[model samples]
Target: MDMLDFGSPRQTYDIRVEYSLLYECALGIGAFTWDEVHDKLDIGQAQVLQIKRQMSEALRREVSLAGLHHTWRSVLFLIHRCPYLPSTTQEKHLPVFMDWLKEIKDSIRTEAAPYLGASYQAPLAAALAGNALDMQKLLDEHHENPVIYQNLQYLFAVSAEQLLDHIKRLVEGWYEEVVSRDRNVVATLEQSAAQTSALSQNVSHEKLIHTVTRGGEFVAEPGVTTLWLIPQVSYRPFTIRNHLPGYAVYYYPVDPDAQTGLDKNRLISNIAAKHKAVGDVLRVRLLELLAASSRSLAELAQAIGASKPSTHHHLLLLRTAGLVHVDGGVYGLNVDEVLALGEELCRLLKLDGVKAAQETSQGR
Candidate 1:
């Protein structure tokens, strides 16, 4: 067997920022969590609980029936491939999105096939055919140790048509019950998209991704022709990454204050926050440890000789300052941001001075 090359030439791909209400809705649904990690979310536990309580029973039932509470990431596979006009209203696109899902139901399994291991062909074929016995046999053959197979068990058990219907209902219900009422969220998303799109035009792909994701790095991957940077609010402070056949999607968190109109004080405060985040000896040590390698919360806490809560607090500050990032339950230092701190500070200070001079001239 030949090993596949994962690298692609830089010129082969372009990055763009996109706005989609349906995509945001999908992400918002995924962000709903009841675990201890809910504290890490921008919405926080109280709001999440409120959102759950406010949901209609029918919508709640659909979400529960489809196991969306835990398996919501699966919906992104379909969302990434769905054909819809960019920045269109969700109401207009929901029906079209559902129709497209139904249309592709027969071949839906193929979208996920590439991500699975080489041994997945038999089970994937069985899944597509809705053959329970064959799927069981393949699962036994593989010993079912593959996490992807476990994650997608529901898809294998039902026909694509049935699975998509469940998805359609869950998404539509989420929109009607939760998304529709939050008109301000759509405006925020549009503003975020506009801000990011403008920045993308002015910056390199690397810089744009780092700035938007607050510390993410996007390495070129084979076969990906475009990188979609979709701004999202529901999962603020965390970025969700996904890949399709020809594109890479990053549903990155939007800066809440970016759309709130910038002022000199706000700019200065933002710069100060970054400095303040690194002002502590313990925090600096944490960064040193992360610089060496990615570490889990427990590992980081143990290494720094601090309680988990204290370490989590320090990490939260570092993360907010764009100096750290957690992926796959491990925290890694964003070395690029750390190295460019001086340059970033100077850039912001110069902009602040320019803005102040303009304000003085305008007599604001």
Candidate 2:
């Protein structure tokens, strides 16, 4: 695959930051160690074929390049481990766990050990118990191995690089099938490609990439360092690389100031401004403590390293901004609003009971 380097730092940071949002959502909701949510994820043999058909059929209809890019990445993501797709609606359109349930056990072992507790395993087992073949087919078709983590009642595994390749092929097969069946979809896609590409030498110094390709195509690549590529040369980057069937190359950086055409600072400034209301060091610490769980006003103040009266004053402000709310003598973040933010907050903040208890004692 031709590695075109788009030399821009601010742009790259922008892309990574937005991508982080998706990852955050996946980590938060998808990783919920609860039992009820885990029980419904059953990918029977027929369902697996359906997933293949939906994607294959979509391709036959001239899949939107943007949709295809995200879909391909989603396939890669599922293969890695089923990720929890966050949604605000009451009902989920797709099973959050899917075939990825088996990988959850390893993720727990590796990434979430301390905070996850043992509550997650039972639900996880419930989710994966019936789907015996989805992940196996995913791994085998992709030519990768699921790392042998300890066996829970369920088998969880993922293949990193190869899975990505698998997604690429699926996209290609769909497109080929579509071109044979429907001429319009392919023609419309060609005319509306996301970016125009030509051999351009002018690029920023930082936005450089090295890779190999056949007549300009991104081959199956295993990221940058872990595996080395030969015949490496530099070029410009494009989404759904030129003439390379199914190879969608996302630029590492998105323009921070311009997403389609908007200022990043403008988008985030108001949020930063709200920090002032609950943004004070003491207020933040105290609010964070309450957010972790319900606590007495006195408890929060101690956690904030302040006297009860001072902390109480700050909590009042947080409540005003709709960041926190008080019930009787206890304080807490509005759980409804917090949950509405999707599962991303699980990492953005941690719930700490010790801080609250300490603060409570201090207030006493």
Candidate 3:
């Protein structure tokens, strides 16, 4: 029942680093907020607004008819197989990608048919619902959402294929115009990945992941065999995931403005949240109690000598700062993350490095 458990790691000889034009386009299309597009992206405000207008004009029919969620859902379904996607807009890979889409459609139908609604279109409907691409949840949702599953199948599927050429063009053009121009940013990302991997060769998998990714740690689950560490620019400071048993992909974001924005580092903001979480003596007592053993919210409230709502609010802050994690109904301390807070603070302040070397170091 654990959503994070996706079997064991698969044995792979090499760790790969690659950029995705598809990822950038997808984020621009639907995932990113207006503030993120204006501030986080390297594009100028006028240019960004122009592109948005063009994109809106181009996809107006689909957006109007099917809604933005369905329109973006089809886009993601086409491009979600990122590891297999070509690095550039090579026309040769287009067919290969389309064939993979058909296979995905087939897999959904076959795997989901038995549990899904009796209607023939049930699987395709669920696929088009455009939920985040968590495969485990995809399989489980027939039980969880039978009505939405059964009703919405054919609405988007009919138009999804027709919009393929337009989507392809949008992705390719955006890559050429916007993403490719940031060659130095891309190069720095590749170099950083190599250095992080080298540094982690002697370290534990979890610690290495934490050091490299800032917040996310690697999990050696039962069926996961390979991990792809892809670096993304538009989706800064979040470790996005597409998890599977043998193969998993984590999209770690890169700052668009590498010099100043990244130099100041957002981890300082997150670290401040961490400080605020434990700033109250009552919350500190709650963390201490949870460190010994996992406890329910009521139990934590009783131990902390605070009301349930107050204790729950304190726990929410800790959870937001990634200092605590919930498993089942039991709240447990994220012990390593809590411990690494000081180390993170030291790294942020440049106190962990040698004096001369410290000045030249980027935010950890």
Query: Highest lDDT, which number?
Result: 1
TM-score against native, each model: 0.60, 0.24, 0.44
lDDT of 2 by residue, 1-364 (tens): 9899998554221111012222222222221222243333331232222222323333323233323222333432442333343322112312333223334433332221111123433444433443456434433533432121122111233333333333344434443332222222222222212211211123321322221122243234322211111110011111222111122233222222223222233224323434557547777676567667899966766666788888777776665444665555667666543343333233234335556777899994
Residue 16 CA displacement from its true place in model 2, Å = 20
Best by TM-score: 1
Candidate 3 residue-wise lDDT, 219-311, digit = tens: 665456566666665555556665433555667666344445543445667578789888989888888998899999889989878899988
Q: lDDT for every model?
A: 0.72, 0.35, 0.55
- Quote the RMSD, in angstroms, for model 2: 21.2
Off by over 4 Å in 1: 1-12, 66-71, 87-90, 105-126, 130-147, 261-364
Candidate 1 lDDT, 1-364, residue by residue in tens: 9999999755645776777777766777766633555788986775566465445567777766544323456666666666665545655777787777778777766543334443566666766577778767755665544434454565566566666666778888887766775556667777888888788788888888899999999888767789888888778898988766567889998896764553344456656777898999999999999989999999999998999999999997787666887765688887766776776677866877888999999999
Q: 1 or 3, which is superior by lDDT?
A: 1
Clashes of each: 0, 21, 12
